[model samples]
Target: MSWKVTFRIYYEDTDAGGVVYYANYLRFLERARTEALRALGFEQARMLQENRIAFAVRSLSVDYLKPARLDDLVEVSSAVRELGRAQVVFQQQIVRAGEMLLDAQVRVASIDPVRGKAVAMPKEIREKFKTLMGTPA
Candidate 1:
């Protein structure tokens, strides 16, 4: 299933032209993914502090289709496209009033925060991601 979160574009999020800065789209996508994980019963801070595990973006490709203007309300949607032993591929998009604004595919890898090395996700965490992957978006 897809997880969605909405954000309002503020002046701080925009450039001099009043359009959302391109880099802010990454922040929107990150927040959506974090919220999605929270909805699935995992908290990133707890995961890092207690389990010593943190997630990092391995790679991403984004397409900026349309610009979002200041004061606009945008929705960010995220879904698990693929799940692996220590990583997941997320298909995400940003939309405004039903119009697609951006499309992205992000690969995230679980890692040991201290060592900064890739690590296998705990069994429970992987299982939860599997469930998400099986659900319809």
Candidate 2:
């Protein structure tokens, strides 16, 4: 299943031509992922402080298909594509109305906050991700 969040494009998200800046698409996707995690009962800040775990992007690839203009209402969608011991790969997309504007694959790794090294996801977190992966694409 895909987790989706809607956001309105503001002036800050755009360039002088009123089109969203290419880099801002990454930020939009990030927000959706954050919300998805929250929906699963994980809050990043609390996880870091209480669980000593943090997440970081390991890799990302994006395809820009169309430009989103200022004032457009966009939906960012995210779903787990692959789950691993130390990393989770997510497929994400940004769309306006029904048109896709960007597609991305983002790999995120769990880390030991103190050691700053990659680590296995907490058992509960891993289980939650597994459930998400089982959802229909």
The candidate that achieves the highest lDDT relative to the unseen native structure: 1
TM-score of 2: 0.95
Candidate 2 residue spans exceeding 4 A from truth: 134-137
lDDT of each: 0.91, 0.90
Model 1, range 1-137, lDDT digits (tens) per residue?
A: 68889999999999999999999999999999999899889999999998999999999999999999999999998888999899999999898999999999999999998999999999988888766663223
Kindly give the stretch of ten consecutive residues in candidate 1 with the minimal lDDT sum: 128-137
lDDT of 2 by residue, 47-85 (tens): 999888999999999999999999999998888989999
Distance from true location, Cα of 97 in model 2, Å: 0.8
Give the Å shift of residue 89 in candidate 1.
0.6
For all predicted structures, in order, the TM-scores are: 0.95, 0.95
